[model samples]
Target chain A: MALPLVIDIAIGQLRRRKRQSIVSIMGVALGVGFFIAVASLMQGFQQYFVSQVIDIAPHIVIKDEFRTPAVQPAVAAFAEGAVAVRGVKPRDEIRGIRDARGKLAALEAVPGLAAAPTLRGPVILRYGARDHSVALVGVEPERERRVTNIEKDMIAGRLEDLRATANGVILGIGAADRLGAGVGDIITAVSPRGVAVTMKVVGLFSTGLTALDQGEGYALLKTVQILQQRPNVVNSIRIRLADITQAEPLARVIEARFGYRTESWEETNSNILSLFIIQNAIMYSVTGAILLVAAFGIYNIISTVVHEKTRDIAILKSLGFTEGDIARIFSVQGFVVGAIGAALGCLLGWALIEMLAAIRFDFNNPVLRGQRGFIMSRSALPFIFAGGFALVSASAASILPARRAARLNPVDIVRGAA
Target chain B: MSAPPLLEARGVTRILPGEGFGAPPVRLVEDIDLTVGAGEFVAITGPSGSGKSSLLYLLGLLDRPSAGAVLIDGEDTGALSAPALARLRLARLGFVFQFHFLLPEFTTLENVMIPMRRLGRHPQDEIRERARAILASLGLQDAERKLPEQLSGGMRQRVAVARALANDPEIVLADEPTGNLDTRNAATVFDVFARIVGEHGRSVIVVTHDLDLAARAGRRVHLVDGRIVSDGPHSPVVPQAVA
Candidate 1:
């Protein structure tokens, strides 16, 4: 019941000293507003990068390779773990999965899983007296669409059109530009097995990745296997899960189930993911530092209020106000200030985000050549975080001053007045 | 025997830390015994540094005694927690300091309403009405909305007295409340205290150095070096009985 009275007094005190109160509020608002703005921009870029990785790339890639080299039978037979086999050359290693069809069928039965087998090998593209080195990927168009976004990236012919045309090929826009070819153009591809074949261009795609655009081509799975002289063999099995975050665990499960080397997109891009972590760490620390500085402003204002209100505190104490009441009065003032500041900051931050999103950044930089405006995330998380942080900061800043106010001895002050 | 003393101090003592290392601790009040009965007007008088204000603080429950207990309505307050003692003070006692230490941020009515609000027994409207009535009784109805700085010294002291009586406590303890007032205002303040004891049937304990004002009270307790030098009726007719 006395809380309302305490709040009234607290607000009265704050209103009486309007200049200091407003200054402290502005300081906190600035901290929270900048925190939200920076977090939105940074998180927007991260989400953009993650989307690109998940859209164009497979969630997990199971390859015909081993994470660890096979130990020789002779090395394990004798020598107590210290045996080094000398000059024992191994036999020729098979380069493709022997049971890819079985593996693909098994993967299809797993819940929320999609898999596509690809016979990928290096090749040369020869068109009209021009020769270019490129890697050829063989994919079943329907299954491939479940694993990657090749269907969406198609700007020319349909990806399903490759199903009817046995030797139909898809070239990236960069490759098509270099070859001076479009749909229905004939191109000669020389497989790594030294077999040359002519395939008709069926589709062209632009995925915004320069390396993939310029250096890769896709064709039907049976055609590539026949051309490569490895009939019915696939070197890679791409998998996509319903939840991208589930990729790592599912990849480990698949690796353990089959003796295949499996890697999730997160594992393959661990460096970039770690960089995102560092970026988040730096962003939050900067935000926290600004909030800490703003807390000092609150501290200064509250300390002044305590010094100015000493006589009032003594009077309240003489009137039988508990020490806790005195402390609550000041703390309630902090709460009011902090709440108002955070609300204003959220509005300010939202407006700044809109303004930043509207402003064009036309640097013509290669990485963001066609990107028109700043990437700004619309997530409410950063705003919530900033508001919560400000409240905590203001509350923490009020404690010392409130304690000092409560500790004032009424006798000493009244004696001074006498 | 007479319904217990409204406010009583039995061997009350307050010792603070010494000024220098290894020096003897300073005793603000030592073993001072005093009592104020219902409807009694009592004055405590002493020279400067003689513990008049300190003893008043102990009796008001604003300070804890180092050795003995101060009792309110026969309840020993020694073992009460700080908040419990504050509650006891709010419900049973009120205090007026020499400075009329009203909160400057609040108006005169608001200052008076603080104790009533802390006591939390009445609704806001009732509190406000009671506050206005008290201010009106003290002839401050027109000045209720004025800040403490806007009031005269005497009016401010009267406002302080109104605030002390806000909760209608059993005992009103004042420490040199008229020390800063002129002679005329001081006489008015003494008259207010006499009426509070006589008409309202409440005990009034005042600490002052004005010997003339002390002589008018029903009883006067004189202290020297934290011990009572004399205590008894000031006249043959009790002041409260006459009023």
Candidate 2:
């Protein structure tokens, strides 16, 4: 039989049960719509969180610590346990990267990478009668700006003031608030090694992370090295890359070359990323269940149609329609419903997303201070996925009924009718 | 002997399997041999449960015989595949049932066009024109656009006849085509069947309980207990061919 005739009969049958067909179509449409809406909402927040992490954190961090402790010369030389070495005394060494300048130069020469050195140590800031402990990081102002977002986070004095003014420091807004200090305030900073210095605060910045904002401060490398009594020593090298996804591979290369431990941002935030996976699984499974339920509606209506039109089926069979043609006729009804439902679903999903985007939350929480409304993704992937899923499910639901209709023996029906 | 019969059944038998395990099967029809020639109108008369419709179904290729073979135009149909049989039916045969089972959703015209469209032998416009002509020949030209429910019983049966002739098949098999109609409507339906054989030179096999209707056919076959009891002209002489 010609395909157009089959489609014509399929459409005619659907029109006969107009109300049931519309209901089944609406079920499919709602399933796809909610799938798109929920997917967009979840993915939008996830992308936002990822972007924030990428912007505020170094893509790769090369620490002063080695990946493995040094082995004794005897242990290396002796042939496979022939000589057992025990309790070897270790030599004292400085706790910092030994050829920081050479390593930084090598990293900076690579394309699309920025490297900066920092000396980080603990210190106590005393202003008036109050004292707060903070991690004092020593950095070169020009290189640090390229590797971090400190310049953009500055609320008061500029980062370059650390080079212009002698003994200037940049304090985190939370740290400064606890110390009751502001820019240009002269404060005493006492290092763990008992060395003390009077520092002038030049800038205040907030990074939105509670730990960093409350317990970190930045100053020039010279001043911090002197205060920590570890002159000419840099403890860490932070790297920023043009493509942040390259962090893991580049970190491995740097670690292998330098014999130091390296960490990528993905590894550092693996817990949260894994949580996103669970969130996505839950989202898809829930939406899939809804689509499956909608598919049952298609199944119910088609089965009822087959039962009600037994005589018509018998007549069609006797008129020379093959079993395959009968199957195609019924399957085409499902295809038509699925196609129309998917199209309407995409539009409904877009409308739902827009409605969600318009809803504003009135809350005083600092974490949500800048967000005006719900985060929603506008990418086309969710719409396509939901529509495609709905179409497949709806078509699958029709196969059983179509097969049953096709297998009906016309002889029995016609004789029974007589 | 002028030409091989249009349809021939050789000792055909059909058994319906029993419902439970180890139960004996029941025979719907057994050892029935029949032949229908082109341009001959034959009526099958039988009492209830005598398998008149079963014989017609076997002749129409709607049911497979268990013990014997049915042939169409001297071609044995037992070896053909299901799809091949359906194609043969599409090209060479048509059927009407006791009930006017016109697709309720389609108009009279579209109902008639179904078989021609299924055959796909002609362009759509030609099929439409041919379907209109057939309906007009059956006195249903004014009822072309009306749905089956809108028409009277006789009109619907006539529409069914028009649909049966859509592909211009060599044979039209109708099972109790006018069983539910009044005397006038039954006469109209029988007249349409007579015209199909006489005017178009097509064979028609009808199953009916009414012997008066059977008496009008060129040949009559009577069945009892799934076996033919008589096979001859209903009158003392066979009806002469029309034109």
By DockQ, who's the top model here? 2
Which numbered prediction scores highest in TM-score against the true structure? 2
TM-score against truth, every candidate: 0.92, 0.94
Is model 2 an incorrect, acceptable, medium or high docking prediction? medium
Write candidate 2's Cα lDDT for A1-418 as tens digits: 2448999999999999899999999999998999899999999888887877787778898898987887778878874777777887767678999899999999999999999999999999999999999999999989998998988878899999999888999999999999999998999999999999999999999877667878999999999999999999999999999988799999999899998999999988999999999999999999989889989988898899889989999999999999999988888888888888888888989999999989988874444436777789899999889899888888898899999999999988987887
Which parts of model 2 have CA positions greater than 4 angstroms off?
A1-3, A72-79, A82-91, A364-369, B235-243
lDDT of candidate 1 over B5-117, digit per residue (tens)? 67788999999899898988999989988878888888888777889888988888888999988887788989899989889888878888888888888899999998998
lDDT tens readout by residue for model 1, A124-158: 99899888877889999889999999888788998
lDDT, residue B170, candidate 2:
94
Residue B214 of model 1, lDDT score? 87
The alpha-carbon interface RMSD of model 1 comes to 1.8
Give fnat for candidates 1, 2 and onward, in order: 0.81, 0.81
